[model samples]
Target chain A: MIGIVDHGMGNLMSVRNAFEYIGAEAKVCREPGELAGADLLVLPGVGAFGDCMRNLRHRNFVAALDEMVIGSGIPILGICLGMQAMAKRSFEGGEHEGLGWLDADVVRIRPAGREYRVPHIGWNDVTFEGNNPLFADLPADPVFYFVHSYHVQCRNSGDLAATCDYGGTVTAAVRKGNIFGTQFHPEKSQDQGLRILENFVRQGGQC
Target chain B: MLKKRLIPKLQMKKSRFGNRMVLVTTVRFDEVMEIGDPVSQAKIYQAQAADELVFLDLDASVENREPVTDYIRRAAEELFMPLTAGGGVKTLDHFRMLLENGADKVSINTAAVENPELITRAYEAFGAQCVVVAIDYRQDADGREKVWIRGGRTGTGLDPAEWAEKAERLGAGEILLTSIDRDGTREGLDLETTRRVADAVTIPVITSGGCGLACHFSEGFLTGKADAVSAGTYFCFKDENPMQTRSQIRNAGIPIRIQT
Candidate 1:
């Protein structure tokens, strides 16, 4: 079972519906106690980094998340801001500490030129980096929906999974052992994104 | 690099005293034309491989919030593409409700002009990416473009380019710039104003109101420099669907998502 952790942020329905659309049994697990029975965990968010961490701790989800992700080593996937919440720190709206899952930071996208535009809205292509399972069988032209101003900057190069050219090469996806993350939204990315989600569900979070 | 988008604009309204949401279109912001069911039309667009869909609630009155959300929730369930909804969004609760229900972004027109502070507040809460400031304007007899409110009935006397700059400064992620004069005209997009506003702001700009020929879509990107171009009547009244239009745009050397 894929349990979508509800940290009180973003569009959870789209994510849940995307999973259900692909014939996967997924539930929006709202309660922290409900996290034990799931084979895989999906952290989805679209709000501020600080608020997401606060919500997880306030809703008593941090301890449950630590138990599952660290103790039992359950496969986990984070989307958009949920990916940033896995980082060590973020400099958006002031400095804030993150969940420390990956050695990374969330910072504003400073385009090389003023004409490059911020927020990086709309569909952009991402090229898979390593032999990660997340890119299994995706189309050669893989484009996903992106709408974020802050992007993930990974400290460790080994965690990089995919990248997209904005003003420069922006980290689009990352994977570290059982932890997987995508800066762009697979739920909103249509067929290519659905294929990636299916890959995430099929693999055991291993490269 | 982000690919240019080709979005279908669905002008939706509930039938008088009825619960069904009917998809409608506008010509120069005056004559109203009924299209079809919004949900069914959305499916066609999804099948046609549209990049995204925009739902504009014409009757965005406070009394109509309930039915408006019902239609949004229904459409969001059937379509997995990114949906940006707008019309009469006044407060932060509206943003929360739409996002919770499934809208990836919400556009504000009169509400943003009436209360510019709401843009900053919505940004502080939901982040700038979800907050879209919809700017509708009309060119006068003297070739001056001023912002229009209340479905283009009332005039704000504000310059579209200047207002776009203020909107971006106030934390809006994108600008949905619509030219009331060219809406449904089929002549072409208002490249003059589209270029002005697109150059004024550093954020992405979506130019609406004048997409007729296949070349118009490419013009909006190449000449107008808009990040995206949207058309309602052109797609509704004409045989040009998103796939055909996307090929035309891509053939003109614009990097848009390939048709699946």
Candidate 2:
């Protein structure tokens, strides 16, 4: 079973629906105790980085999440703002501390010397950097829906798994061992997105 | 790279069956023509790998009712692509209701005009990326672009270019510019007006109405400078789907997503 951590931030139903569509038993886990029965976890969020962090801490999910993802070594996936929360800190509204699971920082995407717009909305191609189980059985450079102004900047290049170009190289996906994060919303990316969620569920059992 | 988008606009109305929502095609925001069921059509679009889907509740504004949240939830369950729901969104609560019901984005037209602060408020609550301001406009006898509200029933006397610029400054992530003149005419998009609004705003602009052929989509991207093109009549009236439309646009030398 997969437990989607719902900390009162973004739409958790969409993520849960996607998992159900792929024939996986996924439940919206709103409390820390709900994480005990699940072997796989998903942290899904939207809205500002600071607000999401505040809500997570308010719901007391930080410690439970760390225990499940780090202490237990359970495979986890973060989507969009949830992915950014894996970083050390963010500069969205102001400097706010993150989970620091991945050695990265979140900052606004600044397209240098171009007419590229912020909040890089709509569908864009994501070029895979290395072979990862998250993108297994997917076509080369599949398109995903992106809606954000800030992206993760990984301090360690080895953690970077994929990227999408928007005037500059924007961090699209990252993975470190059992921990995975994708800046795009797989639940909103259609067939390509369903394939991604299916791969994550399948790989979680192996981990 | 972010490729240009080909969007299929689906209008929703209370079905004659009484409780369900059915797909309706409108000409200049009136003269509705029933197409089919919204949920089934949305599934077909999802299978075709449509870039995004727009669901506008046609009766919401005219009937003075809230958007069909039930219909939106039904469609979102079967769709994986981004969904934008609009029509009769007047308050921040309305925006919240739609977002909570699986709408990835909410398009505001009537309310945003009556209260410009609604756009900013929605943007503040949900990030700018979630707020889409739909501006329905037509040229007056003097050839000046005037903004239309209440589903093009009344004119706001605001220029489309100026209103678009203000909308961007107010934190609208995208602008859905629909041309009332060419809407349902099946001639082509009003490239000149689309260009005017697209040039005024830095954010992505989606041009709607007056799309008869796939070439009109290309023209909207190439000549009109629109970031995306939305069509309703062309896709519903003709025996075509978004896949074939995308292929035609791709063959016209415009880059579009062809999901394998």
Candidate 3:
């Protein structure tokens, strides 16, 4: 079973609906104990980075996620703010510590010039950096729905899986071993987004 | 690069023939004409991989009824793209209910205008990404662009460009700008007004109303500089769907995501 970690932050329903649409047996796991049977985990989130971390801590999900993702090597994927929360820290709404799963930090996206808009809300293309199971069989460059002001900046360039040009080259997708995250909304990206989600589910077993 | 979005604007109302939900279009926000069923048309757009879908509940606010959440839920089940539901969004609970029922975004027009603070509250609660402030605007007899509320029946005398700036400052993630003068006219969008509002705000602007042909969409993006273009009567009454429209727009040299 694919367990979607629900700490009361993300659009869990849409994520669950997407998984179900693709014939994946996924459930919203609110309690940490509910994630015991799942081989793959999806950490979905939205809203502020500080509030999200506070909620995770309030629900005691930090330690549980660390065990499943780091200790036991269970593969996990984070979406939007969920992806941002995987970084070491974020400056959104003041400095906030993240899961520290990947060697990256979340910072507000800066517009290159007057032509670019903040929040970067729209469908943008994701250009893959290197081979990763999460993007297997997908388009060379797939467009995904993005709605955020901050983006993840990877410390190690090798961990970067894909990048999208908003103002400049912005990190779109990241993958380091069993952990994966996307700055865009795969569930809302139509066929391209579904393909990415489907690929993630297909890779669940191998991980 | 972010591809320009081609969105189908479906106006919802009780079918004149029966109780089933149907698609409708209005001229100057009146003279409603039933065209087809929203669910079937939405599925067709979904199959064509339209960038997004916007459903405006025409009767919700005017009739003082809740948004057609059931229709939204039904459509969301089959459609995988981003769904934006608008009209009659009065409170944060309305926003919550819609998001919970499968809408990716909730757009408020009249409520957001009457109580601007609602935008801030909703944005603070759900994050700025999910809140959309839709503005219905038309030039008055004196030729001043003014914002309209309550299904465009009441003119607020507010400058659309200024209101768009305020909405963005209030944390609205997007602005859905509809031109009342061009709605259902098929003359093309009010490019001048659209350009003005789009230029005034930093957030993405979706221009709706007065979309006659596929070329109008390209004009909205290329000339009007809108982030997205929404069509109502053009897609409803004409022989064009999102597929044909997208083809025409893509042929105009704007990159759009083609569904394989």
Candidate 4:
């Protein structure tokens, strides 16, 4: 069973449903005990970075998640703001500390020039960087839906699994051992997103 | 790089902006008893490759107009896509509550027109990108188009083109313009009205109402000049599924990229 951590951000049901849609037995759990029963864990969010961190801490999920990914070696996936929270720090609403699992920082993607919008909303292609089980079955550059202002910039380029050009090359997906994160919503990405989830489940969620 | 979206609008209710002639009301949400749950509805839409999930609290005003902040919170808790909540939002407090709950975007309709300053205030509070001005329009007696609020139940003296420009100036990041005349009719879009607004503003425009078939989406994009097209009736799960319509549009070379 895959355990989806219920942090108080949006996009919980869709992730759960997507798992169910792919025939994966997934459950939404806020309890750490639930983590022990699951082979894999999924963390999803769709709001501000600061609020997501606070909610994770408030629910006592920070330590539980850390244990699940680092201590217990359980495979984990983070989506959108969930991905941002995995970085070392975020500058969303002032500087806030992140999970520090990956040596990265979440910063706003300002339009360098021209008329690129702030919140890069809509569909964009994801170009694969290296061989990863998470993107199995999908095209190397499939268009996935994205909506966000702040994006994660990995300190070590080796951690990036994929990159999508929004204003420029933005980190779209990252994988470090058993821990993986996607900046876009696979639940909302249609077949490509669904296929990625299916691969994540099939790989038994390993590093 | 932000790729432009091709949205299909779905109306949850009938046209209330006096464009009753061109409208065709269908199985409303309340009437669809078999529909399991709102959260489930969002999940299904997501599974169907819906880029984003938008839920308009259609009955909020008729029953008791409170911000659907709880619904937004609950939906966000379940949905993986960026969620947008509309309907019965009247004040900055409502917008703030919706944001606090989990809405990525707060759509304002009657409230913004009822108190025009609400536009500026919303922009001030949440930044321009977070604000979307949802305008419903129908032609008046003199053949001059007029803007409607309160789910097209109330009409404001402001013209839609003027309102679109004003909204941009007031710091609105996007516009969701629906045509009361073509709503539920499935005939097509209110091309002239939608085009006027889209041409008047520099911000992206999402056209809603009167999407009967796949070609309607094309018309909205090519003729209406909208950045996105949103439809409710055409995309509902009741009788006709939306995936078919989406493919038809894509097959016609509309450049719509699905999840796969």
Candidate 5:
């Protein structure tokens, strides 16, 4: 079973609906026991980074999730802000600790120059860098929906699976063994985004 | 590079005393507007390959009402992509409220032309990234297209080209030009009118009204010189045939959100 972690921060409906749409049995669970029973876990979020982490920790989900996924090595997928929370820390407020699943930090995307739009809101192509089960059948540059101001800066550059150019080279997708993350929204990204989720599901939580 | 956007516009109408009126005018919808829930309809559009979603509260203008807070809040909470809300936007507060509710942008029509000052006010308040000027127009006796105000009933007497230039100068990031003659007709985009206004300004121009076939979208971008094309009927008729239209556009190589 695919369990979507719901802590009242991220968008849970669309994510649940997407998994259900793909003919996969998924449940949005706030309880740690429900999460432990699932074969794969999905951590979905929207809103501020600090608030999401606070909710995860306050609800005792952070520890439970770490025990189930990182401790036992259960396959996990994090989308958008959920992915950001997997990093070491986020600069959204001051210095907020993250899940520390990946050796990365969340930093604001520098505007680079004048007339550069922040919160890069729209479609951008994803270019895969390594062979991964998540991107198995997808094209080299499949369009994905993105709406973010801050981006992930991987502590280990080799862990990066895909990258996209916004104002400059921005991390689009990351994979470190069983832990995976995407800055763009696959639920909102139509076919390309759905295909990515479909590929992830097809892997049977094995990464 | 940005792809040409295809939007499906839904107008918000409310009935007071059982008289259904357009959100922007006192005149009633011919058959009383039955506004489909914006959240559900927007998701339907997203599923049917709509590039973006636009909602205009038609009754807001006639009733001295602002953009419906509950509607905008619900829409912003549910919609996945950038949402553009129109109608009853008269000041910066209205724009801020809509944005705060989850609107990616606000479309201003009569207020920008009538008050004029509201244009820069919204531009400064929300920045050019979130402001879109909606120009409803029709051809005059001299065959020159003229802008319309007050729900496409009252004539503004402003030339389309000049009005577009003024809007761009006022810090509008984009323009939605709807040809009244072609509205609901589905003939094709008014290429000459679209080209004229598109050439008059540097901001992206979204051509509305008269999108019958996939070719119309391609022509709107290539021939009409429009940056985006929007249609309502083609998408709303989901029971009959929706994929046919999407496939045709895709076969034509027009950039749109592909449904897999």
Candidate 6:
């Protein structure tokens, strides 16, 4: 079963609904303790990075999630702001400490030129850097829905899994061992996204 | 590369049965014509590789906030495309209710004009990406663009370009600009107003209302500089879908998504 951890930034109904649509059993767990039975945890979020981190901390999910996910070796997939929350820190709305899983920081998107918009919204294609199971059986350079101003900049080059060309090369997906993250919302990216979520769900069981 | 989107708009109203929401088509932004069930049409769009799906409830009023929440939940449970729902949304509570139900974005038309502050509140509550201010406008006798509200029944003395700039300043992530003059006429899109609004706002603008030919969508992108093109009557009445339409756009040297 998949556990969708809610941190109270916005509605996560679509996350749970997307999972159930793919013939997977998923539950919306408000508390960390409620996720005990979940083999894999899916951290879904929207809104600002600092606020999402605070909500996770306030819900007492930070420490418990560290213990449950890292200690127990269970896989976790972070989407959008949830993905940014996995980084070490963020510069959005002042500095805020993240869950500190990946060696990265979230900062505002400064397009190389002024022609590109701040919020890189809509379907942009992704380029897979290395062979990873998270994007298995997908088409070459598949497009996914993206809506964000801040993206992850990894200090460790090995952590980079996929990147997309916007105004510049923007980090689109990342994976390191049991921890995985995607800047795009797979739940809203149509069939390619559903296939991605399914890959995560299946590969999560093996881990 | 962010390709231009070909959106299929699902204009909705309560069925004559008054129980289920059905797909609708509009002319001049007032006359409603029932097409079919939303789910069936959505599935067809999904098969046809539609870039996204838009659901607007035409019958929603301030007193009777009949949003397409139930249908949205049902579609969200079945389909995987992004859903943008709006119409008669007047308060932040209504915005929260729709997002919680299954809508990816809540569009405010009447409220965005009546109470512009609601845009900030909704933006603060749910990010600007969730707040899409849909501006319905028609030309006056003096050839001035007047913003129309309550599904074009009430008119406000606000220019589409200026109102769009204000909406963006108030934290609107995007603007859905519809031209009531050429709606359902199949003449062409209102490139003049669309270009004006697109140049006014930094955010993405989706031009709608007049699209009889697939090449018109190309014109919106190449000439009007619109980020996306949304149409209800063309897709509902014409024998075209996103696939054939996108093919025309691709053949016209316009960058559109290569369907998977």
| Cα lDDT of model 5 by residue, B1-260, tens digit | 33556778776676453433322211122233354565677667766666667888765776777667666566544455657888989988888677656566789998988988788877655456577899988888899788988777688889988998998888787888988877766688899989988888766788987776778877888788787787765555454233566566667776554543
Give the alpha carbon lDDT tens digit for every residue of B1-260 in model 6: 88888888899887778568889888897677888899788888888888888898888863466565788877777767778888888887788778888888889998889899999998888888888999999988998899988878888999999999999999999899999888888889999889999899888898998899998999999899999999988888658878889999999998788674
Residue pairs of candidate 5 with colliding backbone atoms: A10-A45, A10-A46, B22-B58, B22-B59, B23-B58, B23-B59, B23-B60, B24-B58
What ranges in model 6 sit over 4 Å off? none
Per-prediction TM-score: 0.97, 0.97, 0.96, 0.75, 0.64, 0.97
For candidate 3, write residues A92-159 as lDDT tens digits.
97899999988888998997887687878888888898888788777666778888989999999999
Native contacts, share recovered per candidate: 0.80, 0.61, 0.58, 0.33, 0.07, 0.57
Instruction: Report the C-alpha displacement of residue A91, candidate 1, in angstroms.
Output: 0.7
Cα lDDT of model 2 by residue, A1-207, tens digit? 999998776778789889999999999988888877898999998888888888899989999999888888899999999999999999998899999999999999998643577778878899998889889888876999899999999999999989999999999999999899999999998888889999999876665
Off by over 4 Å in 4: A31-36, A111-115, A203-207, B1-6, B13-59, B62-85, B89-108, B112-133, B139-145, B159-174, B184-188, B191-204, B211-216, B223-225, B232-253, B258-260
Residue-level lDDT of model 2, residues B1-260, one tens digit each, is: 78889888998888877678889888877788888988888877777878898998877887888776888898877788788999889888898899888898999998888899988888778888889999999989998889998888889999998999999999899999999888888899999989988889888999989998788899999999998999888888658788898988889888788883
Docking class for model 6 is medium
Candidate 3 docking classification: medium
**Residue B187 of model 6: what lDDT?**
87
Off by over 4 Å in 5: A111-116, A205-207, B12-48, B54-260
Pairs with steric clashes in candidate 1: A165-B1
Q: iRMS for all predictions? A: 1.1, 1.4, 1.5, 4.6, 6.2, 1.5
Order the candidates by lDDT, highest first: 2, 1, 3, 6, 5, 4
How many residue pairs clash in model 3?
0
Q: How many residue pairs clash in each candidate?
A: 1, 0, 0, 23, 8, 0
- Model 4, residue B71: distance off in Å is 11
Off by over 4 Å in 3: B15-20
Evaluation by lDDT, superior candidate among 4 and 6: 6
Model 4, B1-260: lDDT tens per residue?
35446543322322234311111233312222223345655556666656565667565554455754555566665555556777778887887677666676788887778777888888756656568888878888999989976656667878999998998888787888877777667788888888889888867788987787778887887788776788776665445445666677677666566543
| TM-score of predicted chain A against the true chain A, for each candidate | 0.96, 0.97, 0.97, 0.95, 0.96, 0.97
Tens-digit per-residue lDDT, B223-256, candidate 1: 9999999889888865889998898888898899
DockQ score, prediction 6: 0.68
Give the whole-model CA lDDT for all candidates, comma-separated.
0.88, 0.88, 0.87, 0.73, 0.75, 0.87
